[model samples]
Every structure is written in structure tokens, then in C-alpha cells.
Target: MDERRNRMDDARFDEEIAAEVLPLNRDLTLPENEKPRTGREEEAHIHERKQDYAGIGKVTGIAAVILAALSLFILPVFFGGAAVVLGFIARRLGARSLGNWAIGLGAVSIIISLIFAPFF
Candidate 1:
């Protein structure tokens, strides 16, 4: 009886294995009209896709630097604050070097302005 039961279990396991394996054996090729993508083609496809922010990051970074420079001359507090905000925005958008420069320049402008404000 034990031998018979083992044979039954083996038969069930075989059926289960066959069921799982049959689907995987089907044809996986694309249709005659379609061609597979090469590595470079896939990369180019991804590169050509438009990003949400596009070139806004670099623009913000440039604007931040300009604001920081202008802050050194007039409306130091206002322009410096704007420059710092734009710098942070640029950093968040992937302009690390420009953002850092803008931040530094803005801080220096604000400090200098404050120091000279009492006299002028």
C-alpha cells in the first residue's frame, strides 16, 4: 500500500511539473515585421525622452548666480534672498556646482551689505 501511494504522489508531481513547463516551451519570438531593439537603440530611445523639468535647472542656476552678483550692488537683502532660494532650487534639480556658487555668493553679498548698511 505504501508503494502504491508513493507511485500516485509521483504521478501527481509529474503532472504539475508538466503543466508548469509546457507554457514556457511556447514560441517567444516577435512577429515577422518587428525587430528586436539593440542596446544602443534602447539607450538612444531613453535619451530622447523629454524630462519634466527639461533645462530649467541650468536656467535657474544661471539666474541664481546673476542674482547673487547683482545683490552685491543694490537691494542686497532682497536679491541675496532670491539668489539663495534659486540656488536651492538649482541644487534640487541637479546643478550642484552652480548652486553652490550661487549660495556662496548670495551669503557673501548679504553679509557685506549688512556690514555697510549702517554707514550708508
Candidate 2:
């Protein structure tokens, strides 16, 4: 009968509409339980980077001084060579503090080593 056909067509149309409109992703169906990440992780990441840069500068500066002193004793006139090497490395690594410190300490070490080299 015409009435029955109309009813069946209406049901089929609703089913087709629901299939198209419904979300295909199951994850979307789930309720949003997880909250956003706290600032702790971001803060820690920033802190670690700051500490890392500071450490690099400190260690390289100290090493430059040591190398300058040692090289002056063993080698001829290779003054501040180690410092120059490390200072360049620091610069390349974007360690501005460390590179500056390395150059400064190396200069001081070279001067002191030169003054003392004559004695030893």
C-alpha cells in the first residue's frame, strides 16, 4: 500500500541521515575526563635548559683556565689555545655566558702562565 511505502521510505531517510551525521570516531563519543597538562612539565623543561646552559659556561671557563696553565708549562707559546678552542665551541653551542667566561678566564690564565712560565 502507498501508506506503508511512505512510512518505510521515511524510516530509511532517517537512518541514512543518522549514519552521515553521527561521529565516526569512537574517541569523540567518550567523555572528556583528562584535563590539560599542568605547568609543572613546561616549568621543569625551562629550568633544565637554564641549568644546562649555566653549567656549560662554568665548566668550559674552568677548563679553559686549566688548559692554558697546563699548555704553557708543557708547550712553547701556545697561550690561551685551549680557551680559544672551548670559547669557540661555546659560541657554536649558543652558550653565551660560557663562551664569554672561557675567553676571559683564558686571558687571565695566559697572562698568569706567561708571568710564571719564566720561573718554571
Candidate 3:
């Protein structure tokens, strides 16, 4: 009778141990460094990459300024127009200083062309 009681107690204890330990054991099975990334984390990484390329407008603005400087007479009008457009785009894309410079240069080119239009 004692033997049968001891067997029953052992079985109950084994069941309790398994019930308490199964979840913890499962958690321990995975390595800390191998945890899966969530969707939000992936989106943040992509956003950082996008920011890295956001300064492309600065290049456009610089090119527009160069064109404006190289142009004279009728060409200055066209180059200045191009510079203004590029400046607007650059401003929209967050290149504040470059956009402002482009706009200023384009305006100066247009004024110069107008000032010397009768001569040319």
C-alpha cells in the first residue's frame, strides 16, 4: 500500500514540475541575439536609409546655380528659369540653404539678362 501511495505522489510531483517548467524551457531554447525583428523596427531602418538620400536636392541646386552663372543674354533667361525650378524642388525636398542659393542666383541671372537685353 505504501509503495502504491509513493508511486502516486511521484507521478503528481512530476506533473507539477512539467507544468511549471515547460514555458521556461521553451523560452530558454532560443538564443538572445537571434530574436526576430518586428515590423516597426524594419520600418525605422528603411526610414534611416531614406534620410541618407534626402540631400540629393542639394546637387540639383548646385547644378542649376552653375548653369545660371555660365549663361548670358537669352540663355540666362532659360538657365535662370531652370535654376528657379530646381530651387523650388530642392526646397520641397528639405535642402533649405541650397535651394535659397539657387533661387538667389537664378534671380540675379534673370536681372542681369534683363539689364543687358537691349545691348545684346
Candidate 4:
């Protein structure tokens, strides 16, 4: 009686395994005309605008450099201050090279003004 019960359990387990495995293999062999309805196709068509801070920072950095250059001739105190502020802003915005240049130029202008103050 135990041997007979073991045979019945084995048969039930084999049926359950077949039920789970067969459908997966069948789905994998789908025809070209019968495409699966995954929502990924719609997702693939979506066009998202990427975030870009480099361009904005670069432009601002350029402006800072120009302002710093102008500071030498115009207002060494005021334009230099503006340039320094813009350079720091540009650094925060991601423009490393131009921001550094602007900062250096502004600082130089300010220092020159300070040096000339004793003579004048």
C-alpha cells in the first residue's frame, strides 16, 4: 500500500511540473506576427530632454572673464567685484576652466588696485 501511494504522488508531481514548464517553452516560440504586448514599446518611443549645466556654466564663465577684463579699464573695484561673484557662480554651475580664469583675472585686478592705492 505504501509503494502504491508513492507511485500516485510521483504521478501528481510529474503532472504539476509539466503544467509549469510547458507553457513557458511554448511562449518562447512565439510567431513573428504575434508580438507580445509589453508596454516597453511605448517607453522606447519616449524622448526626454537631458539635463545640461555645462553650456550654461560655460556661457556664464565667459561673461565673467569678459567682465573681469573690462574691470581693468572701467571700474577696477565694481566690475572686479562683479567678475569675482560671476566666477564663483560659474564654478557652482559646473564651468571649471573659465570660472578659474575669471576668478584669477578679477583677483589680479583687485590686487593691482590695492597696490596702486598707496602710490596714488
CA lDDT of each candidate? 0.81, 0.63, 0.72, 0.80
lDDT tens readout by residue for model 3, 27-95: 345355545559998799778866875768667667766765665444888888888888888876667
- Report the number of the highest-lDDT candidate: 1
lDDT of 2 by residue, 1-120 (tens): 999788865634443335455444333352366334479977887778777777676676567656655654555246466776887676655566667766776666667777886797
Better of 1 and 2 by lDDT: 1
Q: lDDT by residue for model 4 over 1-120, one digit each (tens)?
A: 999788865634343345443343323465566455567764553322112677788899999999999988878989998999999999988888888989999999999998897997
Can you give the TM-score per candidate against the true fold?
Answer: 0.56, 0.36, 0.52, 0.56
The alpha-carbon lDDT assigned to residue 63 of candidate 3 equals 73
lDDT of 4 at 75: 81
Question: What would you estimate as the lDDT of candidate 4?
Answer: 0.80
lDDT at residue 115 of model 4 (Cα atoms): 89
lDDT tens digits by residue: candidate 1, 1-120: 998788865624443345442243224345566566799987776666435444777888999999999998889899999999999999887788889999999999999888888997
The C-alpha local distance difference test score for the whole of candidate 2 amounts to 0.63
lDDT of 3 at 51: 83
Clashing pairs in 1: none
Per-model C-alpha RMSD: 13.0, 17.4, 19.2, 17.2
